[model samples]
Target chain A: MSTRFRPTTLTGHELELREQVRRFVAEEFPAGEYLPGLGINAEASPEFSRKLARQGWLGMVVPAEYGGPGRTAVERFVVVEELLVAGAPISAHWVGDRQTAPALLKFGSEEQKRRFLPAIIGGEAWFCLGMSEPGSGSDLASVRTSAVRTDGGWVLNGQKIWTSGAHYADFVVTLCRTAPLDGVKHAGLSQLIVDLRSPGIEVRPIMMLNGFHHFNEVFFTDVFVPDEMVLGAVGDGWHQVTSELAYERSGPDRFLTSFPLLRIFLALRARRAVGAEAEHRIGRLVARYWVLRQMSLSVARSLDAGEVPAVEAALVKDMGTTFEQQVVDVVRELADAEQRPGGDLFDRLLAEATITTPTFTLRGGTNEVLRQVAAKSLLRGAGRAA
Target chain B: MSEEIELLEQTLDALFARHCGPAERTAAAQGLLPERLWARLVETGLTDLGAPDSGAGLPELVAVAMAVGRAAAPVPLAEASGLASWLLGATGLDPADGLLGCATTHPDDDLRLVGGEPAAPVVRGVLTRVPWGAAAGHVVALARSDRGPVVVLLPAATQVERGANLADEPRDTLRYADVTAVAAAPAPVDAAAVLRRGALLRAAATAGAAGRVLELALAYAGAREQFGRPIATFQAVQHHLVVMAEEVAAVDLAVRVAALAGPDTEALAVAAAKVAAGTAAAEVTRRGHQVFGAIGATIEHPLHHYSKRLWSWQDEFGTDRQWSGVIGRAAVGAGADALWPTVSAPLDPAPEAALR
Candidate 1:
């Protein structure tokens, strides 16, 4: 309700950590040598993931007892922002380090944390969210992925569409309908950690707009999940999943997708005398990016300070995603990729961005829905301050 | 916020609540300068905070300007103390002249410098769009001379052509014809520096006004009912409020960070903030009008005071194209290698702002 985003500056230590990531990028993926990516939907390199984890940059928020270094959210933000701006291939460990480890720390049992957190921080484990089924994308409470109680575990049966990297994932923290629909739509649901290697599970590939296999139709049938695999409590799945929204919705990933392309555009512009249009384009894009980083970092710092910035996070995510897509449009318009069929990295990234931008808004939450999410929260907190 | 700023804000809030309203704005628009409200605010000595000897800097001026913008109080709080005193100091003007005001020179002003005696230099030009020119005790402007830029300070008794912006704020013009200058000298600062400072002040003000507009929209939507419920409950209205909130947050962050950045990038930072504020002024006012509907569009409502001020201030310092173009050129000049470093440049937090 308060439209204030408390400004956050990186501490000296956090800035040092940022330099470390920059040094790593310089060593591993030097400029003009690596293929830049669009946001987190870049190349999936397990080798790169392991290298980052060895640097203690993975599962940053996971407490030390569970193998992570227990760094502050802002520190993780510092590292991830550098990697994202550099367009590092973080896809393989992106979901696990970003979502799964936090889920384990918050809701995973001691046994589950010991088993999963170590693998996650080591970058040996990968995760795919099972909240979205064929019928439940934004309306996650309507998930039809049912789980029946068995002797020692639950039997899962349903299909999750648009599950990014399910084929590459080692486990899935799935949203399952554990009980009958007893009048209330949000009740009777539970989160079950299902192993992708379990029997009666199929990770069928779904080609994306960019002709990449980033998504999958993950079908589950009679998949047995032990009682220990249950996340939180039955009928608490809705709350548990919604709790992840802040972390998932607002992060460096929301805005840094097309940054590398902007870098490329700048590089090219430097070689020539850019006209007024290009200058305005580059200037406005950089302006938006700068403010978006501040906004995103504010949310991260607020989370670190134990604030539930649901509205703030939604504001950042929605605005950040839209700004990123606009980044693509600016670069494309300025680059004139249509005429330069086989141009340089600028053209190539522009092609990828033009195609992949639709997914940028689609991936976490569509712009339209996120706007409403933020608006509803705003209205709810009406008259708090004038 | 630091205690000083917090107290200043609280004081301003209470003062505005008590004295600044429809009557004050109406009186000022009709040429009275809102004497009672001005008297109350001046009692706080905020304008003196901008005096050169006071050591108050951009942060202070920005704070007061934003607050003035929010209250829609028609006063020379920022201009008289901030820009006027900050720039005219090297002109050897006596500080005893009281709350000096500065005006930006325009090409249309056709400013010229004919030769004059060393004791009394003459400025021959028409200073255009001088904010609070008619009300300012002493008006100062910058003109081009053979040596370099010249700072010309005009006494309050100088002749003036009164004008007004859309919000009905005074923007009087002053004409000179080999006129004796109260004080004039080779400028200690360039036109670019003056424009940058002015743009930043305007941006801060625009940010403040936009914030108030959002609050008003939110307050209105929460109270106004249609279709059996508060319009805020309607998804359509909520959408407008959310988008306005985004613009307000973005603009506010831009202005604050620009104010925080070190001298190295202050120009680009100010330019970027001005550009963002310009864009926000449009977006917030448009979405704001939609949320308020007819009531917001009325002359009786206070919304117009902020919206009209936003509209006027946005074009004052520099248009969006002018500022954004400067930013664009800077980025290209720095080259691609410095792109991220430039965009993600860390703020060199000012001492007073260290509390943040």
Candidate 2:
């Protein structure tokens, strides 16, 4: 939105961390382990995630005071990008480590941070988000999840669908309306951390088009969460959640999922030394990837310097999603591997990428939402100048 | 590297904003601008700035020419004037008196400069089409020789024939019948090398035009309504607009980087820039028309002007495909590891541009 470009080069620390991630990914989940037809392992294997913990990558951005490595956000970005590039099964810990841990560190109570973050940093705990409801798609304020004050803390009653990793996560961070104020939908909303093992919690797996259990319908019928688990002050959910969306949105993870397929396409074509047509396509894709990487890295640097690059983050997501879809489409075109074609690794990856491409725009807040965010930020920046 | 460069860019941009904005461009749709504009620009000392610094020098003119190109003005300011100014200084010819057009032929000897006179010494040859040939004062033609390719500054009056082309700019066959000429000192340059610099300048201009067009299309999509909602609300349209933005950004960066890559590799960079900008021009224009519907393609609309220039500028230097092959071969030749630095190094030197 700013038309302001940022340099895109990895720092020495980030490059070193990237090498470590690459080595880990190569050894643990090599290309050989990536069977095309089989869907990705639905749950992030605790053992493998703990392996990440050993490498001090699980909470790269969390502060050392909270038992994290206290590396900058850029380092975390490098780690997540490499993990997604390798198709690592991070679905189990992705949300908790990347989003919830950072958000809690920023706004959670000292007690709450002490209790949940150490385990998160160790990859021993996992969490899922409970924001979307039956009728609330990308509109966060439309959430009907209601949390009424009760004896112990608050009782949450709602049904959240399309909640990723809810079945395997230890706890669920939810946004609920605390006070039913008329005509003010966004106010009186609060975020609560509910244990997935609580009474009156139901997690039903929703198998997707590719036969992967990546989502669930999480129901909370009078599920009680202690007041201490509330992320921020009451009625401050909008500010808190919006701030966290920046982290959830901007990253290499958003676009690099299909990179493995790109590698396979390149390898297959490398046998013929990549003809002009394929080379042209790969060049264009790589160029776009390079630009997106710069923008995302800029946002990371902004965050590292303690600046809130909300609009820049939105721009990254908006462009990043398109790049991901483009990569998938190009891979499909290059491989010409149909969904149900003869058993082959190329076909399987294509099948997964095609089914997964739609979500690129839908996830991390829809592109429309991001555009609005960008437009508003643009107007705000213009106003300040004016 | 110097504040003077920034001031020069700002000055040229201001000049463009005052003289070559959409309104002025529309006014020039029928013919080139009045002589007053040219006289005024020359008065700014831009016309003579590119001549060698030793003799009324203008080495700094390339940057200024870049700014002029960025404006997409309907003039051979960059080609006829910019190149002429540089060549005049390089060849010890003063061009302050009037405009001079610099043109060149392919390395192939299709148009032979033999015997002083002939019955039909029609120089039936083509140079990469110059931008403002319809209005050039003189056409300088260069041909490959046993020594090298030397550019002959032929007066526009010496043309034997001329014709129209798809881009709407005038092109001609400048017949050279044994015209008396004094040998300009020094052997001809690598015409291809110099032509690349010219192409790079055009690519920068194309990039500027493409950026403006995409901006207009995006704003229209955001504010314009279809099916009872802003078209920007439509995911299909949003995706299209974003792709346009991506291409424009790529062209913008490539052209700027190429401009800094010096003369030899500038062709490849320029080719990459041209291909990207040209492709973006087509895509964004079509998408603009799609979003705006029938009204956008009409003569009454301003979008056509941008698209016209896009087409003209694209074919002027080289087709997008030609440049693609040029860039591709350079890339393949450079190999993988070194290729990144080769393409990306120019970008590293400009810390301010990178931050900007």
Give the per-residue lDDT digits (tens) of candidate 2, residues B226-281: 79987776767766665565556566555555554444444545566666666666
Highest DockQ model number: 1
Q: Which segments of candidate 1 are over 4 A away from where they belong?
A: A269-273, A337-343, B52-55, B88-93, B96-99, B105-120, B145-147, B150-152, B184-188, B349-356
- Alpha-carbon error at B83 in model 2, in Å? 6.5
* lDDT minimum window of 10 residues, candidate 1 chain A: A334-343
**lDDT of candidate 2 vs native?**
0.65
Q: For all the predictions, what are the DockQ values?
A: 0.59, 0.15
lDDT of 1 by residue, A1-386 (tens): 26667666776777788888889888887888776877788989899999998999999998877777999888888888889888889999998988888888888888999999999889889998887877788777889989998999899999998888888889988988999998898889999999999999998999986789988898998999999999888778988888888899889999999899888777764543389877777778877888888888888878887888888888888888888899888777776636353567776777788888888888875677788778777766665554
Could you say which candidate leads in lDDT? 1
TM-score of chain A of each: 0.97, 0.94
RMSD of 2: 5.7
**Model 1: CAPRI class:** medium
Flag clash pairs in model 2.
Answer: A5-B356, B49-B58, B50-B58, B51-B58, B52-B57, B53-B57, B116-B178
lDDT of each: 0.80, 0.65
Global local distance difference test of model 1:
0.80
